[model samples]
Target: MSWIRFGRCLVAALLLLGAAGVGSAAVAPLTPDKKVERGGELTASREEFHLVVAKLLKDQGFLDKNNTFKKGTKMHRLFESYLQETLSDPAVMDFLYTSLKENAEHVTDFDAFGKALAGEYAVRGLTRLSESDFQELLRVMNVLADRLPVRDCAGMLRPGSAFDYHWLELLPLDDARVYLRLTKQALVAEITRSPRIAANTKEQTSVAYQALYAEIRRRLAPEKLERFGKIWGKPEAAGDEELCWGYRVLLSGILDLPVEPRRWMLREYANLLRPPQ
Candidate 1:
């Protein structure tokens, strides 16, 4: 017979909402009593949980349509060049590198990134559940899982529902698909409705893309400049500040759309600059 155990501990929640900014907050860890016997539970450390959550929230549904590329449109060309340049930025690369390093340093099964960054060192306990308790946990988790937003945070610029999907998925379950959809929808609604969301989206997009472009130029070959285009040129001359800002806002709103939309936009833009066969 399978057994069930029910225990309540504080769940840590330390979510970063945007790019290249540092937030200092200590999260309390949930130390489970002991591992329950009879079933397998994948233990994840803090960094693992943080990374998982970050990936979940990185979907495209979070933005508005204006930020995304329209097929066969001039906007698509601008987007492609802008994106390549942005990705090439040094600061952005540093941010990505830092995030990755932090993730790697703290990915222990015993603790989450929340604990690791906080500099807490200790192997906490994990309570084992009876089969029945496990089922109940699953039930609760399922209900919460089903609540995940399916849309992208494109417009919201905050780590919303899709963001939660990461931590939630860590729990053993069968309702991942259902939860993921809901999370996207929830995020879309939340981001689209807020008046301030647009501003936030613009700010984040500027920071992320600008950093990316800066890094690209710093690291890549000058011969490759043609590929990125004169995007490296002054933004004022190319009307980039205005165009790019609008693009980011749009991308945040529709990040959940088929990656193809953005992908096609980028490809088309690239081909236009240097005719492709």
Candidate 2:
């Protein structure tokens, strides 16, 4: 339902239509075709699925923990100051304003921002899925939804998972829960384990945070920050890059993220994860 509403935006950032960083590759609009389940119908079973997960964990090493932080850690302080400064940056603010303005000129979906910068027109028929083949069409995405770890062109990064979770929801309730848990764990682990993932996530964390950063700045004053901090931040808030990245594959579908902020995010994430030497 949500996917239909949002138009099943695949890893929007990378799924750009062409190398020129243009529109989405045309995919046939998925229409619900009544898929007939035959008597012999079967998907991979639980044991088989676990074996696959095991291989994913083993081969990808996505479960290996590379960093850890509880609430009120230095990571909190780092995020707080870094975010305030970065959002306050003139160039960054200018980009947000212009991107939003230009986007207003073209399409109407203001809520989705990540790759909208690439251009709004999408062609659906270019995909392998034929018209009316909704069942096989979206399920083809299981391949992506299954890869819990966020590897980059260098490794992996996902700022959000709402999209993936939607796909997972198509599974039986019990199976969805188990698979989602497995994938999320792998997703988080990959971030902490791979410096590449960490860096990418950090970059993603910025723009994604910026969407709300303005409101946070405007509304969350001293007492507001204090009250919220006591509730969540405590002496400090939970400082997990993955929290922001929370498996975003970080959405916003704006243009490919700009350069400087990513560099800063990479450095900050490194500093946060590293011992203060």
Q: Give the TM-score of candidate 2.
A: 0.19
Model 2 agreement with the true structure over 16-104: per-residue lDDT tens digits: 31112111211111101121122222234434433443343333122222112233543433323322333333343343344444444
lDDT of 1 by residue, 1-277 (tens): 1001000000001011211011111122222223211133434443454444344234333211222345564344443333333323333233333433445434454334433432211101001112222223224333432333322222121333122223333333444433332222222222233111111233443343333344444644676533234322222233423323322322232222234333332222112222111
Output the TM-score of candidate 1.
0.18
Clash number for every model? Answer: 62, 29
Q: Each candidate: what lDDT?
A: 0.29, 0.29
Alpha carbon deviation, residue 138, candidate 1 (Å)? 45
Worst 10 residues of 2 by lDDT: 27-36
RMSD of each: 24.6, 24.2
Candidate 2 C-alpha error for residue 274, in Å:
29
